[model samples]
Target: MRINQFISHNTSHSRREADELIKQGLVKINAKIAQFSDRVKQEDRVFIKDKRIHKKTQFSVIVYHKQKGELVSHKDDRGRKTIYENLPKKFSSWLSIGRLDFASEGLILLTDSALIASALMKSDLEREYYLKIKGHINKEVVEAMENGLEIKNEKKGAHSKSKISSMMIAPFLEYEIFGSSGGYTKLRVVINEGQNRELRRFFGHFDLKIMDLKRVAFGIVELDMLRAGKYRYLEKTEYEKLRDFLRINAIKF
Candidate 1:
């Protein structure tokens, strides 16, 4: 890994902070000052201010059942509840695979390794959800789900501060409608990629409001019997599957 990444992952410093420290001549590799372009192997010894840095090689993953109303962040300036606040203190430094918006909740994966998180987040893994929305899911929505949709300069469902003006929503991997009742419709949907406020934007274009959204599965990891606000370590089988996936995808560390 690059020296900055090494410091950031093994220490509390961010990459930018690591860069600043390197510039200050505090970071060392094998008793020599590390350059900005330096890379280290497993045998290399890295230190910051003479304190040895230990990079954990053993992989660890946690599966958390994210409850609604909790932000998927470390600390929110708005003082809203954050996932880290509820997670075990040991996992405070772990990285979430992706994000579940504050209003949406369900399965979440956290890992201690940034490389693993980055690989899974960018992969075209399936994300499945059950959702309820205002009004019936009409033919147009079904067609769009199957054939994909294109929006230009329409930011209806996106976050207010989002700078995205144009987005191309890919076709859904699968979708199941359970019919509408009492001004609401329930459906199960699947998509491979996580776009910015994707489903919300898609339905918002049709003037429909999503009343509830919950993810049930991500890739091979399922929410299963885990209750809201509960969490568990990934099963051995689950970890093996994840390892096989990364290996098959030829993801390099």
Candidate 2:
């Protein structure tokens, strides 16, 4: 494994943060300052700030049926409810694979392994959502979904403090119209990205207001019958699938 990945997998630091630590000369391999290109073997010793790191060989993951009105955070200055408040004490320190906005309800994956969380968060796996929008699906929407869309002004559905002004949307993997009438449209859509407010921004660009949005799946994991605000460990098959992914990607825990 690369030095940064080794640190990320064995410690609380992210890969990027580990890189920063390396740049600052705080990371060492066998008592020598490590380089970015350095790879670790099983016999190698890795240390951070002079403290040797023990390789972690095991990880845990869980799925949470996140409900609306809960923040995906550990704490908030304004005292809003966070997912940690609802999770068991043992899972409070786990990191989310991605995020569900405060108003969005969905299946969210959390993991005790930073490497696993980073891998899933950055992968081009499919995300499936069920959405209800306050407008009929139009030709423009269909074209954009099929061919992808690029916009220079992409702040419509972004956080007020967000500095992103442009976006490049990739084409949807698949979409199915469930119903369209009564001044609302319901549909299921799949995309292979977790871009910032992607679905919201896409619909918002067309002046279509999303009344409801719920994620039902990510990659090969399905929400199934999980109740809102509840959580469960990944099924055995799901873990097998994840192991395959990690192996294919050359990721080791």
Candidate 3:
């Protein structure tokens, strides 16, 4: 195993943070400052900034109905408000799995298990979003989006190649399938990639404005009977489904 993985499995810090510590030379393996790629055996001694590692709490999961205008991160440099401010005090040490932009609202999953969050954030895991867009949508556009829409002028992260674009099509994308008399239409978008503002940008490519957007489903978890701005614990069956799916797909830390 890698030194960062050992720190993550035994310390309170999340895996992402563990990698940062290793990169910053704050972590030591057998009295030597650790590098991210350093290997460790079961008998190796570990320390984080001179403190010995200890076992962290078991993984816990929660489903939160994020309100609009709340940033998904813990701290906003611009002083914009965040969803963490509204979270219960007892729910510390949990990391958000993926994210919903400040203008979008819907089901956001939080977990103490770094592995689960990382697994769910993988591009292979399917996520469903409910979108309400302005103006009437055309069947050709819907079909195009369902096939794959190329979005220009978007930031591509380090993990992605340059000129990255999201490529998830609506399963039932017929134009006659959706309608709203008030000039707004609703549709469900199922995608595997969770790039920043991807779904909204997809519609924007067709000159469609997203008035409201929310994620209603991820993996086996759905927003059934759940009200807005509330939270609930996931059931055992849902957890099992997520675990089985991750295992079958070879997603592991």
Candidate 4:
């Protein structure tokens, strides 16, 4: 594998972070400063900051059913409850794959293997969510959403010229209206890309307020009957299924 990939797979750093470390001359291969294009052999020795790197063997993957009002992060300045607090003490070293916002609740994956987390996040794996929205559910609204909508980029600075962009919603891939009742609509949404609050922003264009959002599935893993504020170690079959889904041959860590 490439040096960056090797570093990222063997260490806690992500691929991007590994590139930064190489650029800073902190990484070495077989006692020589490594280049970005360098490849690793099974027998090759890798070091970071002059310390020999040893691959971690015991890796844990957890599927957490996050509850609303809990932060995905480990700490909060305001002393709000966080998902980490709900986890066992042994999982303090694990990292969440992505984040669920303070108000959002659902399946969030946590893993001790950074390589697995990074690979899954970078892949085109689908994340399924069940959204409860306050709106008059109609064919028009569903069609509009399926056809895509222009939503302002929340991250763009005030002075940015192009603030609006089309949020692509593939009818067969990203959206499907499952049920609706009494001005409350439930929809199943599948998104491959991890856009920042894309669902909330998408509905905002139609003035449809999301009353509740729950992620029911991610990639090959389903929330199933996993209770809120609870977590369970991923089964061996589940872990292998995820690896197969990502088309990853092996996990070094």
Candidate 5:
């Protein structure tokens, strides 16, 4: 494999991230600093920073509290704001595991290893989101969403359904869902799917307006007391827990 490809597959660093590592003189091959275009043979020793490459410690994960209007990608063609700009200078060579639309704000996971990112992004990984919608959400609508609905494109001959797992519903605190144009309304929703704009699409189907959406939890990683726009290093235990989760859940074909 090529050096860049090797880094991408073994760690959460994207192709671009691997290139940056090469430029920064952090990646080594066969006891020598490796270039981005260098080819990696099976026996070539790879080192990231000062540590020898090891599958157990190869990836680092972080949960970022994204703000509205920030693009999830590292760079945007339209010069729009990006989450990368908000990260500290040392938070380098990481890529988002999944995306949060510019209009949404919530927990976003980023990683330095591509393999770990791929594992967590798989469909079986259960993610949790909390949404505040305008007005009362009819119980029937909730059931419809839980049961899965035919999305817009699937409205034709063969309808398709996007299912939510482990849904929990209750009334949200009146003040919790503030900042909407409409009057205070009681709404509480929890969903397991992290599909793009999924909560908004579900509300749109019922003609209900969504005021705010936040992803509160991802697997075992929860927002906890981490303030918005702040991030911390993922401890070794956290990474091991995630790896164990994947090990137990990975599907075999």
Candidate 6:
């Protein structure tokens, strides 16, 4: 693996931070300054700030049933409740895989292994969401969405003009409509890529308002019976299944 990946896997730093440390001349390999392109071998002696780094023998992964209104970050400037607040104090070192906006809720994965987290993030794994929206949706809109739609960028300032920034093709890999009720419609959407506010932005193109959005699953790991505001360590079988789904072999330190 690359030096940055190795560093991130063995230390508390992120890949970017590892790169920064290397660039700043803080990392050494075999008594030589490490380079960004360097690859680590089992025999190479790697050190950071004169201290040797060792791979973790064990790691932990957890699934949290995040509740709406909770921030995914460790701390919020507005003093709102965050996912870390709901987790046990021992999980302070764990890193969240992805984020759910304050208005969104559901399954969020946390892990102590940056290797696993990084691999999972880089993989094109599918995520499923259940959403409730206002207004009626027809086959034409669905088809258009499935094919792709050009979402225009909103004005940045009061004096700015809106323009077509980019196109958002069928955000959903698969979708099923559960019909409508009380002027609202329920739908399940599966997407391979996790773009920022993608679902909301896609529906906004049609002037449809999203009333509720909750992630139900990530790849092979489903929310299942996990209650909101609660979390649990991933079962060994579940973790193995996730690793296999991501096509990642055993994580070596």
Best by TM-score: 1
lDDT digits (tens) for residues 134-246 of candidate 5:
66656667566556665543212111343433222222211233233345354445555555556566566677766676776777787777787888767778877876876
- Model 1 misplaced stretches (Cα beyond 4 Å): 11-17, 41-44, 52-55
TM-score of 3: 0.79
Clash count in backbone of candidate 4 = 0
TM-score of each: 0.92, 0.85, 0.79, 0.75, 0.68, 0.82
In candidate 6, stretches whose alpha carbon ends up further than 4 angstroms from where it belongs are 1-5, 14-26, 33-42, 154-167, 246-253
| C-alpha root-mean-square deviation, each candidate | 1.9, 3.3, 4.5, 4.7, 7.8, 4.0
For model 1, what is the error of residue 79's alpha carbon versus the real structure, in angstroms, after optimal superposition? Answer: 0.9
Which residue pairs of candidate 6 clash?
none
TM-score of 1: 0.92
- Can you write out model 2's per-residue Cα lDDT over 148-236, one digit (the tens) per residue? 99978668877778898889999999999888789999999999999988998888889888889899999999999999999999989
Tens-digit lDDT track for model 1 on 1-253? Answer: 8999887667767677899999999999998999999999879999999899998656888989999899989899999999999988988888899898889989999987877888889999999999999999878988999999998999888888999978899999999999889999999999999887898998888888888999999999999999999899999999889989988999754
Greater lDDT among 1 and 6 belongs to 1
Sort by TM-score, best first: 1, 2, 6, 3, 4, 5
Tens-digit lDDT track of model 6 for 70-95? 99898878899998898899887678
Q: Following a full C-alpha superposition, what root-mean-square deviation does model 4 have from the true structure?
A: 4.7
In the range 1-253, model 3's lDDT, one tens digit per residue, is 6776666656667668899888788888879998878887757778888987754545678999888999889888889988778888766567899988888888899987666677778745677777788877787676776577665555432124335554443343322335676889887767777766676666667777888888888778887778877889989998777667877878663
**lDDT per prediction?**
0.89, 0.90, 0.74, 0.78, 0.67, 0.81
Candidate 4 wrong stretches, greater than 4 Å: 1-29, 32-43, 48-51, 56-59, 152-179, 248-253
- Candidates sorted on lDDT, descending: 2, 1, 6, 4, 3, 5
Q: What C-alpha lDDT does candidate 1 achieve relative to the native structure?
A: 0.89
